[model samples]
Target: MKRLLLFILLSVFCLSLPLSAKAEGLRFGVPPWPGVTVKSEVVCQILEAMGYKTSQLEIGPPIIYKGLTTDDVDAFLAGWIPQQNEMFLPLKEKKAIDVVAINVDEAGTSLCVPTYVWEAGVRSIADLAAHAEKFDSTIYSIEIGSGMQVSTEDMIANNVAGLGGWNQISSTTPVMLSAVQERIRGKKWVVFHGWQPHWMNFQLDMKYLEGVPGTEKLVSNSVVYTVVSNDFAKRYPQPYAFLKKFYVSGAVQSEWINDFGFKKIAPEKVASDWIVANLDTVGEWLEGVTAADGSAGIDAVRSRFAN
Candidate 1:
């Protein structure tokens, strides 16, 4: 009887212990964009608190989408629409990728000019030809193979809004922004692909162009969603649930961008500080989510964030 009692006690003790302190590791696809970098970091910290290991892969959107469909990448937080439709829509239609949720809705991405230039009569993409000399018939872009570059290419090919003969100048986001900054400082005419929820919108006095040939729907309001592999929900329902509930306003993300990029704060510190101060908001994301040990996710995050 004593031996049986000892055996039962041992089983009870084993059951009482939490499951692996670190569950399956999650990989997040993070582009070089500051907003997504900070946002992904925040999500990583939250998931880690829930006993899940997390990692961020810094790559461009096209490669990330390919990774998702092939099961190489688990989650991607920077799925920008309209601009990314070429890469995102087809897979979405085939049911090859799962869009978990729209994390930001108030973002805008398009050809933009300095506000002074806007006031100087270059209010739309069509107006570029009239003053092509001032702009040097050049449209600047971020990164060579970006979705923005694709749109710029289409516009050039179709001569959309008379963009024919207009050439593209491509570089990374910071370099593109630096060119804009230099041009704007001298009051020179410049046009480039621009987006909000970025430090550029905050630091530069620029305006997104109006009346592009296509993009009639939400042209000025780009939507960003959290996307994952097709079977993410079924494979990791707990973390999936938390991610499904993760949403942040464009204003909030812009603030985070400014904090991390402009203010020079580290992304991890920004995410950690935000979670520590906004537990109530974090609680909402963890509403029906749980840790690997089958405990409330909020409880684990709370303990992790608690000083």
Candidate 2:
């Protein structure tokens, strides 16, 4: 009787050990922007190589913040600060979500006009008010719940730059680009929101409008961050360290987005190819890091991607 009891207890302990040691999977929140989607996919791939199972959930900017607060999301790699100031500030004060690190830097987000429109004298955000009729009294923007949309709403609410009655026509990035293309095709005057690290900059001959005297600098900004749960650093030191060291520039993201933007390739494939081609850079990301299962980081990644 005693021997049988000991054997059963040992078997249960062994089985429980494996269950308790299993790494928690990740549920990542991704916004609907080409640059962000591509970047998030790359990060997910890297994390997967490290042995963490990642799920990408496409939620709006607002929902991402809420998700973080509710513990419904594990991370978001597309947190654009200052632009996303309203969403993060209050939650941050409550100790809900934490800013991990800036993943992509030297980014630009603001209103712009075709170079031809600038030639016709709409070279500034303030210039739009006077040419409201030409622009249809509308400022084109991305999805309704985006940070850029919030910024646009603030501008209208505050009547910034004499844009009191201006209507914001909300659309997706592709639709906004189509609007720009239409204006360009007809040589019409149009003012709309624009940003850098986008294929649009390459596709369209457009220029950013100068914000009002003190605001121009703010609109032409950079650096979108990787934000994780506040406890993520303490609970997952290796992943945190790897994310902190993970850095990519606007040029890198723009090129990748452009590659898929013009031609149709999987975002994951682009990221994998980038990883394989830039093994030296990725090696640095994996330095001092280990797989989710505690295996060697670089070796695990190489083998996983190799297959």
Top candidate, metric lDDT: 1
The lDDT, on a scale of 0 to 1, for candidate 1 is 0.81
In candidate 2, list every pair of residues with a backbone clash: none
How well is each residue in 5-75 modelled by candidate 2, as lDDT tens digits? Answer: 44334333322221112224676776656787787787788888887777877667777777777667778
Candidate 1 positional error at 204, Å: 1.0
lDDT of 1 by residue, 1-307 (tens): 5633443344333223322323347878776678999999999999888988887776677777887987668999988887788889999999989999999998887788999889988887778889989998888776644677777877787777777778877655655676678888998999988888888878988888886646443245788999999888988899999988999998889989989887889999999999999999999999988998999999999999988
Superposed on all Cα atoms, the candidates' RMSDs to the truth, in angstroms, are 14.9, 13.9
Q: Give the RMSD in angstroms, all C-alphas superposed, for model 2.
A: 13.9
Query: Once superposed on the true structure, which residue ranges of model 1 sit more than 4 Å away at CA?
Result: 1-24, 215-218
